[model samples]
Target: MFKHAHFKAHTALFLQATGLTGGPGAAPLFSGLDLQIPTGLTAVTGDEGTGKTSLLRLLSGDLSAHSGTRPATDALWLNLALPEHDEATPEQVWSALQQQCPRWSTELQQDVTEALSLQVHLGKKLFMLSTGSRRKVGLVALLASGATLTCLDQPYVSLDQGSIQVVRGFLNDMADHPTRAWLVADYEADPDLDWSSCITLG
Candidate 1:
């Protein structure tokens, strides 16, 4: 049996009519929408151009809401939409991070890298890495970080079937430990996703 979690104690993710595009008369993505996030997985599913990614960005505070409330976030943002820097090698990226704020445990880094099967081309430059590899590296890095909330945008885009399953498992693990709240934006729903809540935009 899965352990019960205290939803009240978990950090909340709020969403209110978040606007994506900018400029005069820039229309809001989904206006007057309210989402109260507590725990477990919450999927923002919709058709293409329905502003699902914008919702994730708003939740992560990368994009600001136009005229409504957004849940308070105490975590860092991870942009899956942004590609890795072209000039940095994966190893160089890791090395650079070590010189800054993060000092990831060597064992955890190795485990995460292997879990994503990224050991094969640690020497490869970011510009040459496949789309899937970039996603894996960023997602895995977020998974290994200290952030308590994860907002992933169209995470299934280039993921293999096995990799998708791994991500699902990782989400489950995060919830089981009550470590973070996952806000996943995807086109289709996975059967195994035990969502505590789901927010949809039409």
Candidate 2:
């Protein structure tokens, strides 16, 4: 069993930005933004093209902000939609992820796999699965990672209602832990989520 640490090492993420602009000559997507996301579930909501994706990218260090500082995180996981490898099956990719991710949890992996009903798709190649199945595989990876801060972009993209319910249940359960944080940016709000905080961009 994973012990929930009562004391948070630091805030989940903090960004002090004068603005988040695109490339040179491009207008700022969002300006004068500052946030201190705490250790719990946070929902980033806003209209499209409002820098929601940019904000998440900056937090995960996948994209740099024009004038902002993203604090260091001890363990961070960013949701990635992997490309289809002709020969790679879901099982192979999952095995590879387990080997590469330092915070990977076997117990959590099993739990998510079962919760999402992913066993049927495990042996199928990434290209063979439906969109929802592929997304579920990625969800399993993100949930099982056990990172201190996990950033998920559009987690409910292709999920069915049943699978979405399972995800919501898992998130509700994970919220009990005092140390880990989940940052989700999506266009639509999940009515069932009990968010620690909700931020709107633009």
Candidate 3:
């Protein structure tokens, strides 16, 4: 868990998207969409084909918009269940991320690692870990990255109940953070969370 005093204080919009529209085909998943994302927790909820992941990708600059404006910003979108480094051990991945993320927090990483019971698997290659464990690895990176805008796609997919609770507890602590934004895309918003905003798609 993060101490409230560890967070920096800043008042600024994390991201803004206007007239956004893009998808796999000629028919876009969503059109003329606008969003004003601010610091704190936000939820993107929708059914299977409702473009939840697509919106996150567009916002994170992982996918180009068909017609809209989303200014560049420091952001991260890591698919928790399937990271790219299949051959690297969690320890290696953590070390690489620490070098890459200018604001990475070693304390948060250690806390999350222990909270998720990930210490035992750090030396094993990612491919050797179970799906839930792999997701836990991604969770550690995501939380510790300390990016201004952190996007999580279906974060709870393969997590066990205890791990799920841990993730939720972390998010709960982050809900009122003053300088960072966390956008969670899932089927429905967790009723227990105090979301700063909730965007529901078709």
Query: Candidate 1 — which pairs collide?
Result: 14-71
Which residue runs of candidate 1 sit more than 4 Å off their true CA positions? 1-25, 80-84, 91-107
Best candidate (score: lDDT) = 3
CA error at residue 160 for candidate 1, angstroms: 2.2
- The clash numbers for all candidates, in the given order, read 1, 0, 0
Q: Could you estimate the TM-score for every candidate?
A: 0.76, 0.80, 0.87
Candidates sorted by lDDT, best first: 3, 2, 1
lDDT of 3 at 46: 81
TM-score attained by model 3: 0.87
Measured by C-alpha RMSD in angstroms, how accurate is candidate 1?
5.9
lDDT of each: 0.63, 0.69, 0.82
lDDT for model 3 comes to 0.82
Worst ten in a row by lDDT for model 1: 15-24
Q: Estimate the Cα RMSD of every predicted model relative to the unseen true structure.
A: 5.9, 6.5, 6.0
Among these predicted structures, which one has the highest TM-score?
3
RMSD of 2: 6.5
Q: Give lDDT: candidate 1, residue 152.
A: 76
For TM-score, candidate 2 versus 3, the one ahead is 3
TM-score of 1: 0.76
